[model samples]
Target: MDAKTIYAQSSDIKSRTYLEYRKDMKKKAIAELEILVWLKSKLSTLYPKQKIKVSKSSGDAFLWFLRKGGVTREPDYHAMIDDKDFDIEFQYADKIDLKYFDFAISKIAKKNKKTGKREPHQDRKILYILKNNHSFAFFNPEWVLKNGKIGFVDAWRKDAYRIPRNKFIKILESDPTLKSVIEMIDVKNYILNFQHDPIGINKEKLSFLLQQIIDEQKIIKIIPNDLDSFFKVCFILDNLNKAPQNINLWLVYLLSFISNKNTTEDLSKIIYCVDFLYSKTELKYNELKSLVNKVKECFKLLKSFEQKDGSFKSSVNLSPIDETRNAVFSINLLEDLTQDLIFYYKTKEFNPITKIYQNLNFIHNTYNLIKNLSMHYYIS
Candidate 1:
């Protein structure tokens, strides 16, 4: 189905119906629960006779089990615990905010120190369950408190894991067929390790990963695969101190490669790079101005090709060809130009050639004249 038809169909669905459907789908989705159960089962199976115990501390009633005194049983069962069995308590709530749990865990770890043991007594075993229907265990207090507190902690074990809502929804919404595709991606360890330590993904590694994925031609073929990897790469890029030169180049390349696949929001993200560059102090005005000019030219070309209203044809490529994708690309280019023009007016930079005050009035007048007209249709 085309975008318009899909959008219309979605609009026809009642909001409450859609929401209830999502809720029901989540309940039936065994992927998350399976992950939790698998982890618990693995630990027990690893040392079946070693007095290992598992418990579901979260709101989920199916898998909450507690292990104590070499016995494992349902958390509600009081038979699994004894005062001498290193009394560990399992608490489950609607949502387990890690920040609060870390604080509580830290207090417990400090108070339960063993004199003869190399590590703190509480450090030997600690676990918590969170709202996301996952369980996390801490073996060493030192490791748990590595970065001082859970909230302040960096990547756990240098692994990044989280079911980011935006990316997840984008994937499902973009390709309804990819529900299973997303499920296949391993996220259990990522979540488990993330709870203990935040993932420490650097720009270079992220860039390399993105390039590798793109080179494999996997992303372009499968929307789910590309969207997942693309967002992950973008997330890492978004958090960086600055977009690395190599990463920025890669992004530009990706943008060009996907020009034919332009969406309004996708184009917006690409335009965001322009705004980011303009906002930075690192790049000189002259450098930015030159880049902006090039973008402006691109926008002019795109404006020429755009049909009436906002939509463009999909045949346009990044080349000089008259295509709709090029036109959409121009929309972002124009957005950046407007931003720069506003900036220049605010800063009052003297025009080297015109020798006049670069005030808001002049900028507004120029923008008004050039703004609405299509770049191709407008004859200068």
Candidate 2:
């Protein structure tokens, strides 16, 4: 079946239950205020001569200032320690998208109101406070960009680097200025005492919930697999009588196993799994090489499927709507991976100039189709 038919059939399907649960989980992991309070007290002592001020910074005027500097998303808090400006953000996840670092480094050329000439925006340091297990870890964007390993993050749908908890611990323990602050506060005890939402649901309850979602949303035939294989895997996992440590990561693997073939969806699943594993484990050179090789293979396959008309031919026959949607999704994923390779990894195999022209042509054709062709069908 084509993407359009499947989407049309499942258009009314609801995912509110699962979405609500995720929303609740996010709200309960509140750490921004506590972290800011601690930083204010500790930093004042660390730098006695320097002035320190920190506060929530999402007022209209501040947001306007950030927009002028080319930032769309507002950081949770702004801190001024001595003369240095810092944008502080707290995240419940161990990893952060590399794009944030890119944004930090990029200086937008904005016209100066007084001089009427383009001038570079002032740079501010980004401080990320990430949650790991029961504690928090601090990440300096500059340090991370220099030493961090970038990988595809499934949650954010972008390539990111992990902010390991141990690194922060080491900094607190070894750094002379920070060592005193560690003595002044009980970091571990404070974090452990922080209120957390308990997982009241057991394996049986979780299985029941999963089954309900599968039925209600009619998500039985998720991507990279058909109905039979999807159900088979679900049944096998259900019989195990044990919940997978990472439910989403397990599903990615389950879907890959069911497919037993390479497709654009399979490529995405591979990247997702790789991202999950890399976050938990140390970076291995051999594994990284293997992942790059797989990326090259997928790139070659996608290029083969590209048609002369700037549209990609789907592996299975699809209607114009379905094909266009699928092709656009595949192209977006391909472009993301290609940029990661060219910019971060510095791979010479791919030509950026050639891709630039190809993407421009694809964009032009898509724009024409949406403008001229779709206009004919408009009701008003």
* Root mean square deviation (Cα) for candidate 2: 21.0
RMSD of each: 23.6, 21.0
TM-score of 1: 0.24
lDDT for each residue of candidate 1 in 1-380, tens digit (9 for 90 to 100): 11111011111212223222322322322233433443445445534655544433322222211111122222221112222223233322234333333334332344335563322334133333333333333233444344333233253333222323332222111223223322322222222222111122323344444322122122222222243344443333334322334443343443442343454334434454443433332334655455545454444444444444433444434322223333333342344345344444332231121101111123232232233343544554
Count of backbone clashes for each model? 14, 0
Off by over 4 Å in 1: 1-235, 239-242, 245-270, 314-333, 344-380
Instruction: Please provide TM-scores, in order, for all candidate models, with all chains considered together.
Output: 0.24, 0.32
Residue 351, model 2: Cα distance from true site in angstroms: 4.2
Model 1 weakest 10-residue run by lDDT? 1-10
Error of 1 at 236 (Å): 3.6
Most TM-score-accurate candidate: 2
Worst 10 residues of 2 by lDDT: 60-69
